[model samples]
Target chain A: MTLLKVEGLRSGYGEVQVLQGLDLTVDAGEIVVVLGANGAGKTTTLRALSGMIPAKGSVQFDGAEVIGRKPEDLVRRGIAHVPQGRGTFPELTVDENLQVGGFTQSAADTAADAERWYEVFPRLAERRDQLAGSMSGGEQQMLAIARALMSRPRLLLLDEPSLGLAPLITRDVFERITEVNQELGTTVLVVEQNANLALKIADRGYVLATGSIVASGTAEELSSDDSVRRAYLGV
Target chain B: MQLFVQRVFDGLQAGAIYAILALAIVIVFRASGMLNIAQGEIAMFTTFIAWNLFDVGLPWWASSVASLVIGFLVGAVLYRLLIVRLGGGHASPLAVVMVTIGLFLMLNDGAAVIWGTTAKPVPRIFGTGRVEIFGAGVAVQVLGLLAVLGVLVVVFGLLFQRTKLGLALRAVTSNQESAALAGIKVTTVLMIGWGLAGAIGSVAGSFTASGNFAVDRNMMQIVLIYAFAAATLGGFDSPLGAVLGGLIIGLVSELVVGYVAIVGPDLRLLPGFALVIIVLLVRPQGMFGSPKVVRA
Candidate 1:
């Protein structure tokens, strides 16, 4: 089942076009990674899909057109975007951060979701009362993911969740992402510059350059491709 | 010692007024990173409304409640009609600041036009009465204002600290984009924050009018300055800091006027402002402000 389908997606900041024409798809209950270097519009693609920016495209999510919707509107429709730079509410406590993520849910549901995420990320539960900003980079990343999960979205869009963390921490982050997909059966479309680790957990992957998808294949095939290795994996 | 106690009591009474006004300023500041220059004028205008209601035979407490509701509506309406178009967070700080200053003048002049330039007496809800504390005779006006401020603080504190709505507000205040991603209605929260500030200001205005025994066009001009100083001293973002800042400014103003021969009564306002400058110089983020930690 195709959870998301996009074609001819055009978006950019004012006077500078990025993601000129891009196409992508993600099946339900599968992890898909979009790999690209800086300025490759990987972030732009996620931003466009989340309705955080204006875009001219046809985005079919769960068989409904999702383009031209507000970010909040998109969240209600079961799409949650864990934005770049770990968009955690710094001043809010860890528990409060999760609570805000459940802004669209009922009070009882929010509490239950919080409890569920705490079981998945116990480090977060221990530091639940601490401010998000005061936490280390790795913990903040975990909190950001947990916060997004609070919405109980069918599709999760993660943009560079591994940015600015140690190699060990990055590996742990990937393990959690894999767990989120394998256990919950949540569809994921993650954009990453850390291609090697991202592709390790990805079922399918797309290589983005400049603004468009240059190549895409099953994770095993893309990981072995000579061109992809030289360009992104540095193998 | 008697004189000292009297001055301290006078300072606390004055501080109560500044504390509420500062809280009003802090609320708006937290929601929209702009200093609302019109806060004082808005309060003054609402106080005039209370006065008119009293003139029509409404009890003082009833009139105040009516004024607060009007204040809330006026604030929400103004944000939707005017401030929203001004581009809120995306707008230039200077442009936003200028718009508020413009509102300050317009609201002041508008009140004068509607109510006339003459002063009107605002009856105190708790009539003329006195209480003795520590050998100091205190008017019911002072005690009443303190009691009202206390209740307001506890109510607002609980609202902001314990409720889910408060969590949404804090999220919006900390990061607007993230709040939107969290499915919190950013614009609605901002509007409500402004409305609450206006309602709070109504109380401050009514209290000011009653304590001073009159409401006039320029009633809040000096009070606004004191409130601004208080907000700045308290770290414009911290509500607790605002209260402490107000009290500190009040005490400094009263003490300087009472004890400083060189400053004289005419220059008493100088000490409070001087304290602000000194504090800012020493601690740029104000007393209770979170030290900004930027990482690359």
Candidate 2:
């Protein structure tokens, strides 16, 4: 089932176009990764899709047109975006952060979801009272992902989950993402520069360059591709 | 000792008024991340609205409540019509500050134009009465004002810490983009924040009028300065800090004026401002504000 279908997506900051005519699709219950180098419009693509920025494109989520919708409106349609740099409310406590994530849920559902996410990330559970800013990079990443899930989103958009984590920590984070996808059947569309690690867990992948998808294939095919290995996988 | 007790009661009464006004300033600051230079003028304007309502034979309490509703709508409308057009928090800080200054002049002059420049007598909300505490005679109005301040503090505290609206507010303050992504209506929340501040300003205005026994265009000017010092002393971010800062400023000013022969009643504001300067020099974040933390 095609959950999100985005075509000819164009977006940018004032007078500076970054994402130019991009197209992508994410199926239900699959982990899709968009691999790109720095400034390849990876973040812009996610921003446009999540309605964080103005974009001229057709975004069909669950067969409903979602272009020009605000971020809050999109969230109601079961889309959650965990933005770059974790986007956790630094001054807020971990528990409060989760509560804010459940902004659309009822009080009972919010409480239950908090417990469920806490159980998934015990480190967050231990430091539930601690400020989100005080947590380490890896823990903050886990909390960010958990916070996104608290909305009970059907489609999760993650931007550089491995951005600032140690190699071991990055592996751990990817494992958790895989677990979330398998257990909850949530569709994930993640943008990453860490092609090697991302492809390992991604079911299908696209290589984005200068706001366009240059190459795309199933995870196994892309990992074995010549140009993809030379550019992204570094050999 | 009796004189000291009298001064303490007097200082607390003044402090309660300043605390309420300071809380209004703090709420707007937290919501928009900009100091509203016109908060006092907004209060002054709303107080005039209350006066007009009372002039037309409405009960004093009913007049005050109606003014609060009007103030809230004014605040919300101002945000929707003006602030949002300027890009809200996305605008340059200087631009927002300038706009607020413009509002200050406009509201003050606008009130004078509408209500005339003369001060109008307003009936005390608590009525003319006196109470004796520790051999000091205090007006019943003073104690009532203090009680109102107490209730406002408790109610605001619970609203921020317990309610979902409070959670949404905190989230919006921390990060507007992420708050929207969480399905929280960022613009609506901001409007509510401004409306809350406006409603709070109306309370401060009514209380100030009740304490002074009159309402006028310039009634909130000096009060605003004192409230600023209080907010500065308490740290702009912490509500409790604002209240404590108000009381402390009030007490210090009252005592300095009473005890020091050199600094007479004419220099009552001197001590409050001096204390603010000292607090700023020693602890820039105020007494309770959390210092900006950046993780490496």
- Which candidate wins on lDDT? 2
How do the residues B44-154 of candidate 1 rate in per-residue lDDT, one tens digit apiece?
999898888999999887888898898898787777777889875555667878988999999988987899989998777688887877787777878888888889889
Task: Give the per-residue lDDT digits (tens) of candidate 2, residues B1-296.
Answer: 77899999889988988898899889878777878888888988888989988999998878988988988888888888878898865767688789989999999889878988889999888888988888888888888889988998999999999999988888888888888899988888888888888888888899889888899788898999999989999999988999999999999999899999999988788999999999999999999877865465
For every model in order, the fraction of real contacts preserved is 0.68, 0.77
DockQ of each: 0.68, 0.81
Candidate 2 chain B, poorest ten consecutive residues by summed lDDT: B287-296
* Candidate 2, residue B258: how far the Cα is off, in Å: 0.4
CA shift of A56, model 1, Å: 1.4
- What is the number of backbone collisions in each predicted candidate, taken in the order shown? 0, 0
* Residue pairs in candidate 1 whose N, alpha carbon or C atoms collide under 3 angstroms: none
Poorest 10 consecutive residues by lDDT, candidate 2 chain A:
A226-235
**Which digits, one per residue and each the tens of the lDDT, describe model 1 over residues A12-71?**
999899987899999999999999888999989999999989999799999999898999
Residue-level lDDT for B149 in candidate 1? 84
In candidate 2, how many Å is residue A48 off?
0.6
